[model samples]
Target: MLAGPAWPHSTPPDHGPDMTLDRIAQDLFSALRFYSRLPTPAPADAAELWAAPDMDRIAYAIPLAGAVMGLLGGAVLVLAAWAGLPEFLCATLAFTILVLASGAMHEDGLADTADGWGGGRDAEHRLMIMRDSRLGTFGVTALILSLLLRIGAVMALMAAFSPIQAAFALVAACAASRATGILMLRALPSARKDGASATFGQPSHKAALSCALMAAFIAALLLVPLFGLAAAVSGLALCIAVIYMMAGISRRMLGGQTGDVAGATQQISEIAFLLAVLILA
Candidate 1:
């Protein structure tokens, strides 16, 4: 008879505060690998890591990764602009880096959401369309348009402001986008029985809310210097409004939020924040 699945085993644990952070860090690292389609380290190596449910880990990981992306993207923008790179080319490169780093996970969700919302006639049909992995015409168009708009905004900001301002704009976009995802998770019920969102969405609302506020604060701090405190406030209000509107639409069409919907929220919010900064600055 075939042997039962051999689960790897571990011995003696540290159980200290540092160990807890290390566990959280390992979980976040695993999530990044999963989202980015990078190879996962062996369980033996990750044995000290505590299990974080999918939705909870995703909720935590998305924003943390966003912050990292923002820093990297800002560095890219500053360096390219200093190198006398064309604004359009610099923006394009920055966008490319963001996509590559996140593995286009949220962008794919945005496209899927667009296809569902545009092509489906009813809630059931919309959910079905979203569940289907095949890319539709509407999805293709939405992806292209989103990228074009993002590129335009980035290029315009670079042309209008100093490299420091451009860098802050990138950071604002990244933080605000992931903040949108957290807000949706806090507000919407999970739409599917078995999915990442369903697993990760079980975290207490307090935790979700705390993370959301932290993200918003990070974005606001980045924007205030470039756009002034009042402008930053206005920009944050715009971001929240856009995310709430998208959440309502997703609830109506999908019957609730799914991973794709969460991803869609992030992408839309990012664009909204970028536009707000561009207009206000």
Candidate 2:
């Protein structure tokens, strides 16, 4: 359907257009990498700011944005805990912040992927099922279960460990979950001809590996100083195991990867990270 990947790679012309920095910033925001040093303009009322040249760079940006947002959400949780907020409330607030920041993009992907895989009998059928916009029973169930598990795991960790540890766990889970998406994108072929995933799914392996390392380092920074280096090592091992499982599943189900599969990886990886933290912390 993509006609041998003939998508144009030319940079947009710089002449005669009255594009505002807001437009560029919106594009970068969607791309999700390289935060702008320029001042963000006054808020606009429309979503037009999100339009940008969809490409591999933007695909690459998604995880970076996810990692940053994960860190921010983690920071919020830590601050709330430090301020004496209840563990349940802190966990809820941190999860809510992540959902708000990412517009639930990964969650939607997870639901769609679950519906597709659970309902379909074959690779072609799975791909078609995932393309549908409507959520099936499996999708709904997967979404509920994943969210509940994540929240519950974080809450349990908070109860068992210090609030700071819980906060670090949240941050690590966020980053590791997104790193799963990057890993899958790097390892698998796109399942569709045209879609957001297709547009941003073809990032180089080197880029993905770099992002993964950065995420691991960030997680380590958050965990090692607080719980000792063993905690960080355990977290990294868990993240790697989760990614490996997702990779196998992706290959078996669709012969490669779909946008929904990538989403599923993120969701599953996040859950895995939280579970690991709960067990190891």
Candidate 3:
């Protein structure tokens, strides 16, 4: 293994070596492993990347990974459409594939955050509710609404545009949403002293900006060509607005953020993006 710095930190590992193609690939793999259910890079590559001093600096790679995921899931919708599946069926299947692909990671977060925020009277109670495995009324309601909204948005986008446009919308929304959620790490403190998110710690402002920029580029490319520059800009603006609102709610309610809050933020941002696409497309 290309050992150097410790597991997680803000700066790149202090190894005397320059950033190479190998390092980039490893960083991408780290992000995929951390964010998705997809198979990660080989163990050797993963170990090397994990050892990089500034592995946390690879935060920018997360949205790139999200784009890749969207591409894969979007392909499902495109293919299903071409196969003559009904728009509703295609949208449902495509959404299901997406949920499976991500192991429903973000959805899980959304459910937990909903249950906690809805049921808890205080921080301790909320955090305790969030950590519980059992689903409650709030969680079930959130999950149902989220699923129905996303699937309905997909169907609506398909109705408004070609299957290709729908696919692009999914990719743009998925990538941009995941990118926006990272804002919490830069904007707020950690709610818990230790947990999944706490393990990686916070990111630098510059690194966070880099991640947002990458996602913005991808989102614009996917959105503008189909709808126009106005659509892309407006859609992303709404996404940013939603992320900020979610961050404020999480900060005020929980005093900071946890992995669940971050995940829920992504879910909400995605819905916001799709709503914009539906309005503009």
Global lDDT of each model? 0.73, 0.69, 0.81
What is candidate 2's CA lDDT for residue 215? 71
What does the lDDT read for residue 107 in candidate 1?
91
User: After superposition on all CA atoms, how large is the RMSD of candidate 3?
Assistant: 6.4
Question: Which is the winner by lDDT between candidate 1 and candidate 2?
Answer: 1
Clashing pairs in 1: 54-200, 55-199, 55-200, 56-200
Q: TM-scores, in order shown?
A: 0.82, 0.77, 0.90
Model 2 steric clash pairs: none
Candidate 3 per-residue lDDT, tens place, 113-199, comes to: 999999999988999999999999999999999989999998999998888899999999889888866776666777888876676
lDDT of 2: 0.69
Question: Which parts of model 1 have CA positions greater than 4 angstroms off?
Answer: 1-31, 34-61
lDDT score at residue 262, model 3, on the 0-100 scale: 86
- Report RMSD for candidate 1: 9.1
Top lDDT: which candidate number?
Answer: 3
lDDT of 1 at 116: 93
Q: Alpha carbon lDDT of residue 77, candidate 1?
A: 82
Tens-place lDDT per residue, model 1, 149-239, is: 8888888887788777887888878876776776776667777777767876544554465457767777777888667776567667876
